[model samples]
Target: MKKIMLIATLLSILVEGYAQEKCDTVFVRASTENGIIEGFEKAGVRIFRGIPYAQPPVGELRWREPQPVKNWGGVKKTVQFGPRAMQLPVFSDMRFRSNGMSEDCLYLNVWTPSKNYREKLPVLVYFYGGGFIAGDGSEYRYDGESMARQGIIAVTINYRLGIFGFFSHPELTRESPHRASGNYGLLDQAAALQWVKRNIARFGGDPGKITIGGESAGSFSVSAQMASPLSRHLIAGAIGESGSLLGFREMLSLAEAENRGLLFQKAVGAGNLNDLRTLPADRLLKMTQRKDVPSFGVIVDGYFFPEKPETIFSKGKQAHVPLLVGWNSMEGHYKALLGNEEVTVENYEKAVRQRYPDIAEGLLKVYKANSDEEVAQVATDLAGDMFIGYGTWNWSDIHAQTGDKKVYRYYFVHPRPGYKNAKTGDDPLIKGAVHSAEIEYVLGNLPVNDVYDWQSEDYFVSTLSQLFFAHFIKKGNPNGFGVPVWLPVRPNQPADVMIIGSNTRLQKEQHRDRYLYLRNVHF
Candidate 1:
């Protein structure tokens, strides 16, 4: 009898423990402006995935501004990621955790450390980079849980891509009350910002303390957002990495965008706007893959952009928020300059002369290479400057000269470690940090990406980098305890940039001559 009683007591205790565990891990619910959403909590952080910020942009609503999500009754489950934007597999590095591709991809994910609405935390909204053609918020490199762990509310949102997002026609302009066309993707971002301002408080995020950040094209979007009146008031700070809209690329005029749209309609045999609207999204997407099809790009619509981004920044009419921006060491490879030629000084000189015949001597003087071995690094610097570095520098310089807020600059130089279990010659030797390499480190998502054989040094760099980002998001300054001092860029002074690497420290700008020369030649 005693043995049976003991066995029964053990069974009861196990059952009670299991029940308690289940209760502790119950799904969390938050009320949004549209409706209540149910999301699961893990490791003390609440995660809400695929929460619709806008109505499905399908059928007639295609190529239009994002519409407000209609209110729904009952609790809606948002545990799974929504579909990614419509795009081709243009980049190999992107790995998605989304449902699928679709035009109805205006959703966002949120990660918060707050237990209740009263615990209002600073928020960071990150935009993914794919040159405005391909990217998704569901990419693992952009997971927000790590930032959430640092007492922040992190958000990742999806905007339309390629033709689905940027298609512009005369009819579109006629229909728009703002008398604009194109830039629908940017408009989607603005809509998402408005959504956050209206609803983030319910998720325990302070609506007034939101920071926007991105890399590459997303970084360009940051500059565009700052310049535009729509989203300027919505952001408290901005973080741009490796690119900007200032002078990197020319924004197409609405008339040029409409001409491209007309060409597309002719290519697709669409009779009119109605026919284009009825065309299947997959068919439209496949047509974009044609070589002759002009790439859909951002436009200087009178709505999202009243004028050129450069004009806005020059006039000091952009957002006056604290700006933290930088670029990588090797944004472009030497091969871009040398093409198929061998890495020789003669070949490097010939390539520079061919590209900039009138000013090759001045460029050669600025980007000097004495020996054959030195040609690769020198060519890489020049190529990187022409590619994106010069534009990023121009943005920082212009903002410092115009804006009232503090500007912090950096040059990320930490090369990612090699892959695990890789054969010899499988991975090319990386000389410096390539473009987009800083995303994982700055977001504290190194562990989320398992492809790299991360070392203790990588983790240390990630920790330090994320600390700077978190501090900036919280207080509009990257400086904090336990990190090296980062000075803000002063107008008309020699800029001090934080060199982020194994031995991260502040360094004087050594290549201003290169950037200035490129600016004079290109602009």
Candidate 2:
């Protein structure tokens, strides 16, 4: 009887302990000033997917500032991804895939690891990149699980894309308080950040420690946000890859965006905003293919984006914060698809001479090569330099020269062995260390496990990189375990930069002469 009683007690204790072990999932109720939203949890991380930061920009709300979501009665299921913003057909192999996308896709996703009533982890809010036309956060690649696992609450967001997201018209302006228009996508991003500031704490995220980052157009949005005083307190720092806030004056101010909207109206033959809203989401997405104009992006609106990004940064009015910036070796590695027969040495020299009359000779001398492929690679490198590299240096230079903030720059040259196309031979014919390649590494998604497997190198690179980033987010300096004593980028120490690659070495005076030559070139 005694033995039986003890066994029974043990069984009961085990059962109770099992019962007490709550599923790692967390749930939170977001109390925005607009309404209350209930978000579920996944493995101790609270996730709110497709939560509307603003009113559905449907019907008369289209092309207008994002309004607050109306109050809800009970818990709203945020399991599935929200509709994607209007976008052009992104995939090239369209023959195999249908463009099943939509326009009413202004939504955001958040992931946090804490469930305590008061614990607030730092937030990492991201914007996806697609040249203002293609990407959405729904890609299988950008899952924030690893980032959240590292204790940084992660948020991935989708904003308006293409013409639907960017179109600005005279009539549209007349309807606005700022009397200016363009870049509804930027406004959408801002709305999402505002939502983070208001409700992130409920998910155990520190609103004050939020870091804004993105790839291409997403990077442009970061620059725009940096320039906007409205977004000052919402973001702490920024990370931009292969995109900068230098050009777009002509594109943003042009009537192309408005014209594209007019085209959408003509396609549906919608009489007004209400009519446009009534059109089916599918039809709107299909109509987004009308023409590739300056349809989406932040404009030089005197209201939100009062001045050009370069002008803003030049005056040192950009958000005073630390930054981490980098670019791939071959940003235009996709040029093979362009099949340019003019990618010859003489042609490139002539082209450089014409485009950069002031420093063409210098550029040609540095990138002088023997073959078309080499010249093509040089051209891609030069383009990357002009678009991303120079901007990165200038950004670091500006901050180091003015603000008390720190700036860290990197060059991602870790080209995986098997990553080279088998058909391309010793030369990297495809996008070698191309744009967005650093993403997989930084996320630790590679599958190599041994010395022979290239993944070991990738693993170390990613681990150290993650540590650097995490350290920066947590304590402002990107120096900690496994990172080679990273120093601040100052005018006196501008030469030192963290080179993230196979060896992960620290170098000085890297790309100085290259960027110096590009300084005189026109965009």
Off by over 4 Å in 1: 1-25, 423-430
Would you list the C-alpha lDDT of every candidate in the order shown?
0.91, 0.69
Task: For residue 82, give model 2's deviation from the true position in Å.
Answer: 1.6
Q: Candidate 1: how many backbone clashes?
A: 0
**Model 1: per-residue Cα lDDT over 435-508, one tens digit each:** 99999999999999998899999999998999999999999999998789999999977899999999999999
* Candidate 2: tens digits of C-alpha lDDT, residues 64-148: 8887777776667676678776666675411111123566677778777776737778878888777777777765545676777
TM-score of each: 0.94, 0.82
In lDDT terms, how accurate is model 1? 0.91
lDDT minimum window of 10 residues, candidate 2 = 92-101
Question: What is the RMSD, in Å, between candidate 2 and the native fold over all Cα?
Answer: 7.5
